[model samples]
Target: MSSSRRVRPLTALALAASAVGTLLVTAPTASAGDYAGACIRSVGSRTSPNGWLIPARNFQAGSSGTCVREIQFDIAATIGLDPADAPGFIDGAFGPKTDRYVREFQSRSHLEPDGIVGPRTWEALISRTTD
Candidate 1:
């Protein structure tokens, strides 16, 4: 198995048009992250020509940053749950509400119901699967 995702850039217009059939994004067949509940990854921030890149840090109730924000966005997209309902979610700050949602997502996706976003949790979110 390879931890490589594929991506085809769509024009901004195309992306703005609709996401139904305009994007070509795929997940890695192998794990791209081994975060392991640690928040060590706090630097590398750039758009990937490849599809999604998993974060190397674990986001918990106190994490806050662009990476956390990205994961927050994906949480709603993957679980099809509205972020507004979770209060402080989707705002880059992993508060108690985000923790709750993360745990709920973990349980729903058959991952450990630990309120931490580790590699597996990142996979579930960035893989864009409800799981």
Candidate 2:
């Protein structure tokens, strides 16, 4: 009924709006570190927490071993490639189908589509998985 009463409600409304704005502005968005996917591992390497090393040797079709399997798992999981349909499906063997998926992931990730997983590719894959 008085000027002070009216001002108090307006001030309260303004404070509420400001608080909401602040929250919206400060809200965290998805980042490279936010990826908590199952494929991510800590290999204790200097490169990434995701474990897959920047390969001393490139991994391409015909490569095989645990590292290859890890790469296949990361790439497939990152790109949402169905494991059931993924050739090898973490079998640790790099085959033609795995090569194709790697190339697809590379192209999407703005990397060279050589189907080879090197340091750069491993970094990109790790970054993407976190995203």
Candidate 3:
């Protein structure tokens, strides 16, 4: 019945649109591994005090100083290989050598021939530790 009441709906719609726009702008089209660049995403999970599990993404190599060497160690461990046998050092840079290891791991895991380490590759790597 008043100006404030009339503007409430408009304000709500504006806020909703703004939020959606923000999410769209911030969200990556694909996960970090989607790009062939030297960056990858590392996800971690920890139990909260409330007994709820929370999964977190450690966005490494993209504005984050994640060393490729560290990621390679995890990937190697994930694929049931020793880092010493891998072609790359535990450096944080993702280079040709790392790609070679990724390819080998993919073949061993029976995944597609893509060297990109997507969610599936990550899952396989995690499974290795569990098994």
Cα RMSD of all models vs. native, in order, equals 14.1, 12.3, 13.2
Worst 10 residues of 1 by lDDT: 30-39
Ranked by TM-score, the better of candidates 1 and 3 is 1
lDDT of 1 by residue, 71-126 (tens): 66667666656636755556678887778878988999898999988777777775
lDDT by residue (33-120, candidate 3, tens digit) is: 3321333334455433344332233222322234344446666556545546555445556666667777787798898746665555
Instruction: Name the runs in model 2 displaced over 4 angstroms.
Output: 1-53, 82-84
Model 3: CA > 4 A from native: 1-67, 78-88
Residue 72's C-alpha lDDT in candidate 1?
Answer: 65
TM-score (C-alpha) between model 2 and the true structure: 0.55
Comparing candidate 2 with candidate 3, which one achieves the higher TM-score? 2
Each candidate: what lDDT? 0.64, 0.68, 0.53
Give the C-alpha lDDT of model 1. Answer: 0.64
Mind sharing the TM-score for model 3?
Answer: 0.43
